[model samples]
Target: MLLTTVLIADFEKAGRATCQRLLQLEKKIKVVGEARCGLEAMTAAAKLKPRVLLLDPSGVEGEGVYLVSTILEKSPKTRIILLSERASDADILDALSQGALGYLAKPALASYLTKAVRAVAAGEAWVPRRMVGRLIDQLAPGQA
Candidate 1:
């Protein structure tokens, strides 16, 4: 079986653990690398070109937007999924504007996260249902 290479860009141990556990449970998503900060995340993404990037907004010096934009600029094919606790309107707006394909709250549920990654890898946006309305209403069309 060919597993998708998923690179995790979360500074916290718990965030990494969550990705590790989910990949372990599913066995189809392999974590190829990890980064503790936004700069490292960009570097790793550029070098590894993983299929998915799990980003922790809080870990990136609150510069998730910049990191997402940079990665998409350098590695346009990489799918970015923001992993965070606070998905405030501002955060969501920023992420969407910067081309983030999805956002997942922390303490991520395994099934949902897996589905999200697949959706993103398939070139589909996967925002939480609760935030879909907000994205449509507030975010610019064709932003991502």
Candidate 2:
């Protein structure tokens, strides 16, 4: 079976471990690399070119949204999923606007994280169900 490569960019050991454990359950997903900070993430993204990037911006050097854009600039084909504990609606929308393909809350469930990785790698957007209405509202504005 073909494998979808994933790069994890998270500073916390616990966060990385959780992601790795969750993703490992899926036979089609393979973790190619990991980064502890923003610069490492940028370099890894360029070098590994993983199919999906799971990013937690709290440990990054610059702003989370900026890192997302920068990574996308370097590896345009790599899909990105933002994982955060304190992600507000505005923050999620901003990252999505900056080219993030997915967003998941920190401590993401295994099902959601794996599903998101697969969806994003397949060129689809992934966000929590609760955020769907808000996302639609943001994207369509008056229409929602």
TM-score of each: 0.87, 0.92
Task: Give residue 15's lDDT in candidate 1 (0 to 100).
Answer: 77
**Backbone clashes, each candidate:** 0, 0
Q: What's the C-alpha lDDT at position 27 in model 2?
A: 88
State candidate 1's TM-score: 0.87
Provide the global lDDT of candidate 2 against the true structure.
0.88
Q: Compared with the true structure, what per-residue lDDT tens digits does model 1 show for residues 10-110?
A: 88987788787787666677888998888888899999999999888686665667788988887788999998877786787688789888888775556
Model 1: how large is the Cα RMSD against the reference?
3.1
Candidate 1 displacement at residue 81 in angstroms: 0.3
Clashing pairs in 2: none
Give stretches of model 2 more than 4 Å off.
none
Q: Model 1: how far is 121 from its true place, Å?
A: 1.1
lDDT of each: 0.82, 0.88
Tens-digit lDDT string for candidate 2 (88-134): 88788889989998898886556588888888999899987777888
